[model samples]
Target: MRFVAKRQKEGVNVSDTHPLVEASTLIVGLAAIFAIIAVALIFVVELALYFVSAEDEANLFGDWLPDDLITVAPNDERLYQTQLLVDRLASHWPGAPYTFRVEIDDSEIANAMALPGGLIIVTQGLLNQVESENELAFVLGHELGHFRNRDHIRALGRGIVLSMFFAVVTGNDAAGIGIKAADITLRGFSRRQETRADEFGLGLVHSEYGHVDESWRLFERWNIDGSSFLDLVTYLSTHPETGDRIADMKRHAELERWPVDGEITDLSW
Candidate 1:
């Protein structure tokens, strides 16, 4: 009877703790549910911010240059030349939604920029510096390569998402986070993306002009002109460093077995 009583007491003790076990299980389940909800909310917020940023960029640039003004030319000859180059390159892509335009900024700063939605602007200074149609094609093709990969959009989206994340965590303003995010996005493109664009651009030049080497030659000329600072700024503000980019281009050229010739298109028209 004593032994039976001890066994019965042990069983009662275990039964008494069952409610605690159930409470613990309930707590864990609630925690898991909360975690999942938090993650889903974060993802939805990130996606929404990304699209918002893209729309904002589109609107900001739209105010300056409306969609109708895309084809407005500062000079007819330059516009015609730009159109020709864009057509040739677009043919290479075979279905890319690319619209090419030359925005003749009289700022005397030799620069070219590729924006989202296939908007490309080549400064008068840059146009005046190039020697041949092929060189121009190479440069324009690089910009087109950016467009095809949607780098601008990706960069903008990334910036927005990251900025929003930062702002949420740090309690900073949206505008402050945005500037930081943009700075981060432009420091370096994803290696895979950059390589893909480089190869695609190189192939376009090769297929069109039979000059696979033109891409590197153009960089070499830019390097010779002591444009490293501008290149650095571009890498920080728009793309990657020129030296690193050239190296990547060279690697791809070797992989594709493209011939190495010092022949460069003269831009001194």
Candidate 2:
């Protein structure tokens, strides 16, 4: 009994498994648990969002625009013309839940992003890159597509999931072990979502215009062939390869029998 007590005091026998193997198994298990919790939470968030009215979404995120962004005045010529284009596009989707608003960010970043409640922000750099009204329309349509599909809300839910995951796992050194793997998975998901948005945008462009001309011109600048850093890390990117995206758009247009050529409208601004 004394020997048994001494052994008990010494703690349970060392695991037969190698220490490294045991640690790895423990880390993998914890990571799996975190992943499961995150997925469940995200599912709950999505279900909750379904019951939340569009008006409620607008009310919740109406003033959520970044404070650091300097938006062009509503009366600015560029802003005015862009708003008109958005209005024209919105007309095509009369069933959309929220009233669309356009804001031009006074920055050089060549990008556009959709926000909750039908807010679309385009950087000045994107405006600089745009060569025609049809190209610009495609961009706007893509953002509108995000709104139509509620991608922005899903993105918000994903962010919340990540935050909750990190909150629960942060203290342990192993917390960071799963981040890169998770990021790669999320990026793949994002790339697919972007492709869907692109497809939707192409359809909208075809619907609005008699043909789908110049809809893919916005991606032309990046349609180079080379094995650069970007190529090496394509899998890690949230966006798909620009050249492939353009090719896919062309193929889709072909399948739909949409004319790829038409009169391109110059941007008024």
Candidate 3:
């Protein structure tokens, strides 16, 4: 005898979960995985940085810098004075791997950047903003702190990891987006690094001058209310707000009982 055909149950072919729900779950899982791998890679990079000597860093990155910058003349009084400060601070850093040098870039941007090796690029605008040696020491110490912690290499390694991950996932089509994404992701890390550097710099300032003195004033001078468009943008930037950093340093000094007041040293150059 022939068997009768039977009707399929309603919704038997469909999954119990909604399509959107499945999609959302998959997306969240993937994101969690990606985050884990990225964090692991970052941790690996940080660990590797410990093994890479500072001399190795200088050798690797020294030539990447431009040699043609209109660096202040070695004989220039201002340059000489700045170098003197560097030498003094560096003396406190016994067994320092690199001999630090400050190069004054003839730019109006009020910024100081730590380059690979011991080179520090200080903008003329930053110098113009300086009111005293203590202020300048704070800036220099901040850069030195970057070097002490090997932040440049840490950042570079983290960027490479993000870029590579994105390039592989996106078939190299979304590398720019990947970089921007990395920058945004790394902003918090960068801010912490900046804060730590501030502390390191503050210590150097105190050690060299016997008082923390005017170090925090550099940030105080740059303090801006978040009302302006540009000022608001700073919230998203890598460095912490200048005012917040100043407050942090003051709090730090108070905790350490480091003297914040002393005779202000004038910058003759």
Give the winner by TM-score: 2
Ranking by TM-score: 2, 3, 1
Q: Write the per-residue lDDT of candidate 2 for residues 111-178, one digit (tens) a residue.
A: 78888878899888778778899999998988888888788887777777676667766886567766
Give RMSD to native, each candidate: 11.5, 4.7, 4.7
Cα misplacement distance, residue 195 of candidate 1 (Å): 3.4
For residues 1-269, could you state the per-residue lDDT of candidate 3 as single tens digits?
99999987887877799889997786666555666666777889878887888989877766566667776666778777887898899888888888787778776656777877788878777788789999999989988999998886776776688767766777544244444554556665778898899898888999999899989775664564333334334422646777788889999999989999998999977
Stretches > 4 Å off in candidate 3 = 1-30, 59-77, 165-184, 224-236
Candidate 2 wrongly placed segments (more than 4 Å): 1-16, 59-64, 171-173, 225-238
| lDDT of predicted model 3 | 0.77
> Between the candidate structures 2 and 3, which one is better when assessed by TM-score?
2
Error of 3 at 70 (Å): 6.6
Against the unseen true structure, what C-alpha lDDT does each candidate score?
0.61, 0.77, 0.77
Lowest lDDT sum, 10 consecutive residues, model 1, at 63-72
Across 157-203, the per-residue lDDT of candidate 1 in tens digits comes to 55555555555547534334334433443343455566676777787
TM-score, candidate number 3: 0.76
